[model samples]
Target chain A: MTIQPAFQCERLCIDLPGAPGVRRIIEDLDLEVGRGQFVSILGGSGTGKTTLLRALAGLTSHSSGRAVYEGREVRSPVPGMAMVFQDYAHALLMWRTVRRNVALGVEGRLRNGELDQKVQNAIRMVGLERFRDEYPWRLSGGMQQRVQIARALAMEPSALLMDEPFGALDAMTKASLQDQLLAVQAETGATVLFVTHDIEEAIYLSNTIILLKGSPAHIARRITVDLPRPRDQIVTKELPEYLRLRHQLFEAFRHEIHA
Target chain B: MMTAVNAPAPAVAGGKERPWIFHAADNVWSALQGLLPLIALLLLWQMLGDSRSPYFPPPSTWAAALIDRTNSGDLIPAVLVTLQSVAAALILATSLGVGIGGLIGASPALARCLGPTLEFLRTLPPPTIVPVAALIIGVNETMKLFVIVFAALWPVLLNTTLGVRSLHPTLLEAARSLQLGVVARMTKIFLPALLPSILTGVRVAAPLAIIVSLLAEMLTLMPGLGALLLMAQRNFNAAEVFGLLTVVGSFGFILNAALAAFESWALMPQGRT
Candidate 1:
């Protein structure tokens, strides 16, 4: 059986205006993400990874081509799509309570009672029920990131786009959040397109990985993970298959650099 | 499950005291701190004045005159007039300054184009325009209001613009994503974000407002505390001059304290730091 693409970027190009003229950031980029699939886009710094995410989120305009959601061309962010920004501090509104921040996404869409229920559920899902009434600034970094996740989940988007959500975290926090994200994705059955530079994180959390190379990014390689659900980090990292896949990805990345 | 990090042992001498009381104590302490210099100046003035000199009245003579004026309602009307000018000018300045500042802050091109001109306007000494304002308005209440507005507007306007411009982009993005309507966005995001800076500006401008209003009154001779001081100066009644000075000082303290109180309540509903 052939899987249909949930998100498709066709010949998308981005132009960033400069002093002289408009400079091209990304060109002739095409990508696909399948439904309910956890896809990781791995790229080095300045490879237009963030610009691509911004275009997908409809925050940045593309100079040419289309980003299609399901089969429809996406001109702007629709209700079925939500994004998690890289900066946890910037992700949630500091002036608002955790519940209010989470409820912010679905404002005007749901009634007060329904919104409260949804917010509660999302907070509970992220294990932030106790901190629902606290402001974002008062919480620890990991807790704040969880609140960001809760906010995205509360939006109830069919697809969640994360831009290096755990990059700012320490190793332990990053590992924990990775597990939490995997669990959230599994429970909600929401398709996720997460961008990361960490190869191990991509391998452990993603079902499919697409590696983008250089400026005006092109797909350098793609890998598929056949790992079972509820994968243990320690056990999985020790597995020969995981090590072999890691080595293969490392080689591909090095080859792209040399090329 | 990190008990040490999440939940620490309570270290307390006492607990369950009213948090509001501590806030009140803090306010009182700061108020006393502000008043200390004024009190020292008053003591020095008293020491410099000999009891025999008519030109330099002693503190006791000034105190007696202040009490006499208060009892006889001699300075009441003058105080009221000064208060009226301050109220009018403050209302006009805040409304105009905040509105104009917000407009300028929101538009980068406009701010850049107009910044130098605005800076030049601010640099023009407010008192220099008093003569022009007096001539235009014919030594009426309008002249006083204009001078007060002229003096007070710049600080509020500049601070408000800085506040608005410095607003965090993430907060704006959050507001946009939340679909907060225009009015809601302004009130919740812009207004609240601009408030602390606005308060600082207003506090700085409050004394200037009083000073300008008093000066305008003195020039116009329109029955204000400043005019009363001018009358005392002309008659060489040092006691009355010192008395009125005391009243002005008290009024300044009251207005500043009132602003501080309002700021405390408005900006921080959950215990000010």
Candidate 2:
């Protein structure tokens, strides 16, 4: 017997309402994400990578075709699934302190002091223990984003959907958050569906990278990262194999830019 | 990356570093700007006017009569009655407005159904309906409350609806994705998003509530500051009348001070902008 994948999309088509009329974003897209896999969807500007992630999370409806989470059809946001929105400031409840914001997903659901325990653990995971009592608005942008991530983690989600989670950060913050994300992923082993336009980020984080291109976006390229686990920012990125992949992907990106 | 070491230790208890007394003082200064003309006029009246004048008694006589009223004990109770009614009406109006406005704002169908009726009623002055209220609810405190609440409800309701309409789409999406139920969504997501506008509405409605409370008391001859003023007027006690006006003005000042503190506390939890 075969293990069921975490997410499966068969001919998934998405049409978003544009100014002129209904515009197709993604059409006839097929994907199979195995359990605990880190799949990053990469695309240029205006590509439907984020839209695809939203569709998979059942945030936005697909025009046609089937998108499934685990064994169930994706109609609404599923249980055991959490999303970290790109705009952390807007996504987070500004009025809530760090602890309360992190506890949002599991606030009333957990019992017997489990809720507090989960909130504390998630805050600790994101290294925001010192700022737990402070409002998200008081924190720096990167810290605010960490609160968003902690909020998702508190859910103890089986599958996590992230849309350019570190896109807005400075280089140092981005690098640190990337490693922290990897550490959390190693510990939790949650299936991650990440969306980004950064080639290096996609290469570093994902087990599989799905490059989306064109207006009615389709899977233009699918690249698999066979790099060893415990990937490092300094060491893994400097490896000969990693360098080779980087050179090839950049060339593909250059061709993409002109085409 | 431990960047929080220099993260500017934000004052946790108070949103601002300034003392609350000073904060209230600052707000009082701005509020007093509009009343400067009245204050100047009163100072002039005190400097030139005689104490025996029936129409333009000196400020000193106003104070004397107020002290007399205080000694007789009618002043404190009347003030308390007026204050209580204003507080109660405000709470009721805010509750009704936020609840109903949130519902209407959340649903286009409901907003459409009620929009026309609300427009018609909100514009028709609450005082004009005083006779209708008296005929139906009778000349009681309930009728007074109903009229005040009706007057004050509009600002909060309309502001809330606008707030909900302009609410960040991403925030709604986030709430939906989190699977928050209707009640939770309102209290946590909707309330905070609409808070600034809600506060704006309440600020506009507060004075209106106070004035309407006074109006109802005067019109119905109920036991409040308004009725006290009416009695003094009928009895031809010009000193008491001027004194009561001064007392009302002082009470308004105190309430404004209280409002400053309340606004600071309520809005301090977090700020969107």
Candidate 3:
């Protein structure tokens, strides 16, 4: 028997309310994400990448077509699926402590000791154990993003949807967080659909990259990275294959821009 | 990263641990500092006023009149009646305001529909309602309560509506994504988020409630401090009039302080540091 895909979208389209009537932000698009696979949706600023991610998470309603998760129609947010937003500061509950924020997804479902254990485990996974008692506002931007990730992790979702999770972070912080995210994905073995505008980030993190282009965007290209497991930042970037993939992604983006 | 290290510690939890007594002493010292200006003003009043004047009495004469009223057991009961009325009105107004405000705020259509009506009602002087209430309900506790509620309900309702309307959309999304039920959404998310604004409305309303209650009492010749003040004024008992006014001022000050303390205690958990 064959295993089903984690998420499948068929001709998904999104029309957001605009001043002049409904505006199409996402055109008919089809994609499938396998379990335990790390896929990055790369696009320019207005290419509807985030909209696609949101639609997959069931946070956005598709104007046409369907988004199916594990054979279930995703009309609304489903259980066992978590999302990490880009604006971590607003995404996190500043009133809550780090542990409380992490526990937000699971507190209502889990019991006392089990809840604490899960919260601690998630925080530990994100290397934020020491800051558990601190408030989100007290933490750094990168730390705040980590707390958000920890919150998503505590849900123990089958699939994690992230929309440019490290887009707002400093370059150094962004690099470190990218590696941390890789470690997390490897440990949990959960399917990840990461949305980012950065070509290099998409190349570095994704096993499969879906490039979105055009007005009311649709998938323009799909490339698979066959790089070795446990990828290193410094070492992998120096490799010939990694460099070639990066160049190809750059060319794809440039072509999209020019076209 | 560098900003995080140099950021000031959270005011709620940071700093060296101090004994309970030290904190209490700090509160007491601050309270004394607040009272300093009042004390100075009273001293100036005593130095300037003539004891024998019918229009203006000295501090000693006012003190004597207060003692006389207290000895007769009239002052305490009057103060109690006024306080009870204000307290009852405030409780009723708060519940109604929050409930109505939440409903109106949650629906933009309802808010827009009722906006003009609410604004018109709010603009009508609260004291104007006192006589109307007295005429309709008769001179009684009900009349005072009606006046107070009519007068004070607007601020709390308006503030709560504004707060609810301004709630972060992302927070609502977060709540929905977590699959929070309606009850949990209201109690855990909506209520706490709307609390600061609710308290602000209550603060404004509390003083208004007291003022309206006093106004109702004076206008209708009801039993309260307001009635006593009006009676003293009629009798030309300057000392007694001044003494009652001073008591009313103190009540206002105490109410304000108590509400402020409650606001801090309730909001501290939300990390306003």
TM-score of chain A of each: 0.94, 0.97, 0.96
lDDT of 3 by residue, B158-194 (tens): 9999998898877777777777788877887788889
- Assess each model's interface with DockQ, reporting 2 decimals per model: 0.38, 0.70, 0.55
Against the hidden reference, what TM-scores do the models get? 0.88, 0.91, 0.92
- Which residue pairs does candidate 3 place in steric collision? none
CAPRI level of candidate 2: medium
Candidate 2 TM-score to native: 0.91
- Residue A47 CA displacement from its true place in model 1, Å: 0.7
Residues A104-129, candidate 3: write the lDDT tens digits: 77888889999999899999999998
Cα lDDT over the full model 2: 0.88
Error of 3 at A75 (Å): 1.4
Tens digits of per-residue lDDT for model 2, A135-242? 888899999999999999999999999999999999999999999999999999999999998989888998998989888999988899988889999999998878
Better of 2 and 3 by lDDT: 2
Q: What value of lDDT does candidate 1 attain over all alpha carbons?
A: 0.82
**Candidate 3's TM-score:** 0.92
lDDT of 1 by residue, B1-273 (tens): 111222233432333223333444567678999788978987897788687678777788988877777788768888998998898888788888899898898899989899899899899998898998878887888878888999999988988898888877766665665556788788756786777878888888889999998887777788789988888889888888978898899899889877876777665432233
Q: What TM-score does chain B alone reach in each candidate, compared with the true chain B? A: 0.85, 0.87, 0.89
User: If the candidates were sorted by their lDDT against the true structure, best first, what order would they fall in?
Assistant: 2, 3, 1
Q: Top model by TM-score, which number?
A: 3
